[model samples]
Target: MAASRNLPIGFEASVAGGIPILRVIHESTAGDRLRAVHGILNGTANYILTQMESRAIEFDQALQEAQAAGYAEADPSLDIDGFDARDKLCILARMAFGGRLKVSDIPTYGIRQVRAIDIHSAHRLDSTIRLVGSAEQTEAGLEVSVRPWLVGCRSMLAKVEGVNNAVFLLGDKIGMQMFYGRGAGGDATGAAVVSDLIEIARDLAAGQLSAKKVSGFLDSHDVGICPKPRPVSWYLRLTVKDQRGIVARVAEVIAHRDINIDSLEQEPHLPKERLSFVITVEPVSEPIIQRAVGAINAFEFMLEPVLLLRVE
Candidate 1:
């Protein structure tokens, strides 16, 4: 039936049961033109990050707690690896921009490397971290990514804690609109199903039993994905086996890229064998920072890969 109707037929169909579905495809109406859509779509990732921030726990500890709370699966690869959020972002981007999108097309960065020291640095800056999936339409084209973002303490994204989810939509006419609630769990899912059923029942009573096709899905144009670099403040956490000359080596790389370091901090009382260096750089384009990070990661002293986070 979906094939005949030329519907958006993929993930939802596999698990939606027999219920009639209605989705708010942003591009379907002419009343508003979408500018951007950003969301925290994975409950497990959110739960883990929340625990790490509020409880001052490590990534593995938070993951264990999330598993015990039934928020995370035994494997949890999709959630931890950011693929789940990437898939959700693709659907949202397709709806907002009216084009075909694949999960592989979007750049994805997971939260597995986030450490307690990174969380402490964010706390010092009056901010918190969350995995954000975002799609924005620019003059060049659509820019999309799924990664950890440093959200300010006063921002709406930071207020979204625990297993709750939030989606922020920016439109031409509406400006900014936020939708927040429980993004998972049986109770929330059941409520959503019942809401859809009630709306369908009402439409049926009105003698309008037709399915509304998603205009964006129906459109055939391919979404142009342009990788435009935007200037942003960054949080970099590097764990090294030795601290000697490590800062100078990393600083040289950043200077070579013409990026200025706003501040550099190293937490005290850490073992000399395993030290953490937190660096905050002035607003610079992502490509510049990526280049510097690439150079820094190449150093033999690095115990693990450097963690790069976008500062809100």
Candidate 2:
């Protein structure tokens, strides 16, 4: 209706709070083609992950702290489970890539399973964990997902902490640009809302209250998913009951798939009945690793399903 009537719609507060990211992608990049857009889109999830990294706390403890601090809701499934980020990613990807994206189509994984032990392991590897939403154009199609990534300590993504959010835009003319600020809060969101209102009012005064055609959002064509995502390093955390052949059995599954194990370390002092094994594997696609994980999960000694994190 708005489009038909040339009525302007304001939605800047819906995504990254006060960052004005939607405007930047919708207007500022008009002259350039965006190659990719990715970042830490959820402040609640980021707060939890940063707390886990800085205080060395478990996911539950960090989550409780976030809730107490008012950064997360009592039921934080939307934020912590990657769905919140997924919706936001859909908006950004459509704006940047010019396509119709189903919010449910994007694969999402949360930080609920992340543990203090995982944080400890990340530090050993000089890295930290972050929930990242990424959408990039590829020859096959658009490759997009929202998941926890094991980012290096020195990487820019790892530097975004607390309730802060950061977005990176890659374009042919702009190269790479980053927008950083408080992600979600009354102050940030209110400011964004006001800015949108001000812009709408100005346009009304100028007698130019016309709907801007955002290609991706307006286009009826569906975005395509990549057929085969490129291979990358992976981290697999397995909890198992310590048995005589546990290591060998797990190794055989990986070996059978022709995937190379980069490194394997078992946390010391864990009870024999419940042990945590961290395995880093060489670059491999998702399907291959899932196949290996499935075989390993079926073993009788396994206590829990494998927790997989992509090593960035």
Which candidate leads the pack in lDDT?
2
| Candidate 1 per-residue lDDT over residues 249-293, each given as its tens digit | 888999989998998998788999999889999999777898889
User: Model 1 clash pairs?
Assistant: none
> Candidate 1: where are CA atoms >4 Å away?
1-22, 25-29, 192-214
Query: RMSD of each candidate?
Result: 6.7, 5.7
**Candidate 2 lDDT, 237-304, residue by residue in tens:** 99998989899989999999999999999999899999999999999888899899999999999888
State, as a TM-score between 0 and 1, how close model 2 is to the true structure: 0.87
Summed over model 2, clashes come to 0
Each prediction's TM-score versus the true structure:
0.85, 0.87
Model 1 Cα shift for residue 302 (angstroms): 0.5
Residue 295's C-alpha lDDT in candidate 1? Answer: 90
